[model samples]
Target: MRRLRIIGIGAGNPDHLTLQAVAALNTLDVVFLPDKGSEKGALRALREEICRRHVTRPDIRMVPLAVPKRAEAGNDYRGAVDDWHAALAEAYERLFRDHLAEGETGGLLVWGDPALYDSTLRIVEAVCARGLALDYDVIPGISSVQALAASHRLVLNGIGESVLVTTGRRLAQEGFPQNAGSVVAMLDGEQAFAAIDPAGLEIWWGAYLGAETEILASGPLAEVSEEIRRRRAEARAAHGWIMDTYLLRRSR
Candidate 1:
């Protein structure tokens, strides 16, 4: 039986690697790194940096696999996502079937905690569902949510209040959650916060958290909304891609 390790490398920082993740990196016979094309080259570079800094295994191989791009999510959002996952599953099965050998332990480095907004866990599940004889373990890492909070020096919740994690699309549509003490929006490609009512909201926003290129903003949401948008645009233009999340707290 072949074994796989899903290790979270954290939000673009080598220091955020837990001891478990470092150990996992050293134990791998091969680490499968996804090539999401040249646009997000920094992501691949960070994975390599993690291995270079932590893995002491002699002759451990780093294999690059091409990641398929998701098609435009037009109208049928769920269907489009399903199709993308299917394509990724097919790609993964082929990669494992052809590249990985029996009794070999392979590793995959996830950007953030596997349980968070990442699709790697689900994609791996789809590969297993396709009858791939593989068993896996997960190693959690610092998530953007935590990093965002830490960067701004604030806590996610206030005095037993609730926290809501949602996608940007929903936040744009439903507006601020009625009872949620704080709302964190991830996968927010559309800058949904800008479109929503910023009244009574304080936002702590961070991009490239824990990295040298990190940028952070915090203040009344109405006042800094444009600033965050401007920073995001500049960061994206400079980095070719950006991974960011923001926390919105209701003002008391």
Candidate 2:
């Protein structure tokens, strides 16, 4: 039987590796890292840095998991994603089946917590569903949502009210939740907040969170939205990638 540890290294920062995460890292016999090409090489490098900073174990293997560019999600977004996920499952299955021997432990270091917007757990589940025999444990770490709130010095939920977390597409199509006191929007490539009516809305936006390249903006939505858009675009252009999250609140 093979054992796998899915550990979250948090968003972008090596220091975000919890003591528990470090212990898990030290226990792994092999680690799989996604090589996202040169443009996003910085991401892979960050993961490597986390391993170097922690993981004091001897002779641990680091395997590069070659990731394919996801097909464009045109009209059929879900279909495109399903196709891509299937492709990823195949890749993951190969890594596990070939690299992980019986009774040996393997690790998959996830960004943020495994339960968030990340797809690694889903891909791993898919691999298991394909008849792979393995038991996996998930170790949680700081999420970008937490990082966003901490950086902004704002709580995600209003007093006695719940926070609504959703993607940019849904936020655009469904509008703000009628009762949500706070809303955190992520994976928003289009800067959807700029499309919404900024009246009575406040925003706290952060990009490349938990890293030295982090940029934060907060103010009345109308006033700060353009700056976020400009900054996000410029940062993405400079770094070739950007992961951002923002909180939108119903102004009191």
The Cα RMSD of model 2 versus the native structure comes to 1.4
Model 2 worst lDDT run, 10 consecutive residues: 35-44
| Residue ranges of candidate 1 with Cα displaced over 4 Å | 37-39
Model 2 lDDT tens row, 89-170: 9999999999999999999988889999888889989999999988999999899999998999987988899999899998
- Local distance difference test, per candidate? 0.88, 0.89
- Candidate 2 residue 52 Cα shift, in angstroms, is 1.1
TM-score of 2: 0.96
lDDT of 1 by residue, 82-162 (tens): 998999999988988887899999999998789897788899999999999898999999988888988888889898889
Name model 2 segments beyond 4 Å from true.
37-39
Q: Candidate 1, clashing residue pairs? A: none
